[model samples]
Target: MESALLLAPKLVSNPSREFRSNVRQFQSSFCGKSIAIVEFTRTDAYTNHKSISKITSLFSLGKKKVKTIKRETVIPDPDYRIPIVLLGFAGGLVYGDNLLAAAPVGLLGLLLLFQTTRVKFVFDDEALEVKVGEELDESGENVFVGGKNRWKYSSFVNWELWWPNFPILVYFKETQTKPEGQIHFFPVIFNGKQLYDVMVERAGPSKTSGPN
Candidate 1:
């Protein structure tokens, strides 16, 4: 009876069988967890790499694609040769004894006589260029000076035209320090309507107010 009771407890316990079942469950769960972790890591890495490649490609394309296209026009400056020459001659007459004073007056006369009477307007998609100079080209036409200034299209705000009284005035947006914006005045000689139309088309339409 004592031997049977001891044997009964051993059969009920079954330690080896329970231990084997726990080991199998642990191995199956660990394998599944490791596979899921590997898949998540690989997916994350691929997505990050693809996004980086696309951004790099966009920057490369922007750098290569930028280009500039330009056109040139010559507008004659208002003829003031008569007044300039007269003023210079008068100055020389009044200061005849002073070579220093007379020299400047004489030089002024000569300079004005030879100065280019036209302003060369160069237009690019980006900016407007103004060049003032008197150099002849191979074809015997007056060319502009080497140096030039540009007014960007982005700075422009609005323009006004007065038809027959036609001096088109263009205004730019003001900054904090400058209460009044910069103003550009251009006198139209050829065809006011046509020139205004072209300017509006190229400059991308703005508030055009008044023949006033």
Candidate 2:
């Protein structure tokens, strides 16, 4: 009876072992497939991310870079010839014993000298403007009837510099101030050569010759 019992247990154990072995084989194959699928999904996502980044970089490189330009001042250094001449004339009048005439002339000379120290002629790409002081402050309203201090070169009707060799005055007519064209005159208190050159370059050549 003992031997028969032992034989029965051995037969049952054999079937259980085979069943376990088959289950293990199925689990191992399923796990291996799942691992392969996960790896492929990760690789695809990584490749897609890399491609997107590369395309974004290329687009950034294709964009145009904008350049910033600064406004240029035409008269960096002021000229005092007009004021000096006036002062010299006033001195001559004083020497001639004309106190009344010398008084006014001397005041005018002083006024012009003060103006020269403060006034600046600034030029940008399109227009000529009057700025004041080292800070280049706005010159405010025009002393003339109708217009701002700023004037477009396109509006100029005609311009001239007197006595090209010794420019003492600058005259320009522009329709910007009035449709009939208002005449404007300024003493050449700034660098005459630079002023003439810039005027010709921007406002075009005048009927009068420029300083040599």
The C-alpha TM-scores of every prediction are 0.34, 0.63
Q: Candidate 2, residue 17: CA error in Å?
A: 57
- For model 2, what is the error of residue 186's alpha carbon versus the real structure, in angstroms, after optimal superposition? 0.7
For candidate 2, the lDDT comes to 0.72
Q: How high is the CA lDDT of each candidate model?
A: 0.44, 0.72
Candidate 1, 1-212: lDDT as tens digits: 99999988875675332211111111224323311111111113333332111111111111344566654443334434443654577576767766656666676555544442543444456665555545422222223312224556556655565443544333333122133544555433224445455556556665646422
lDDT of 1 at 90: 57
Deviation of model 2 at 149, angstroms? 0.2
Clashes per model (N, Cα, C within 3 A)? 0, 0
TM-score of 2: 0.63
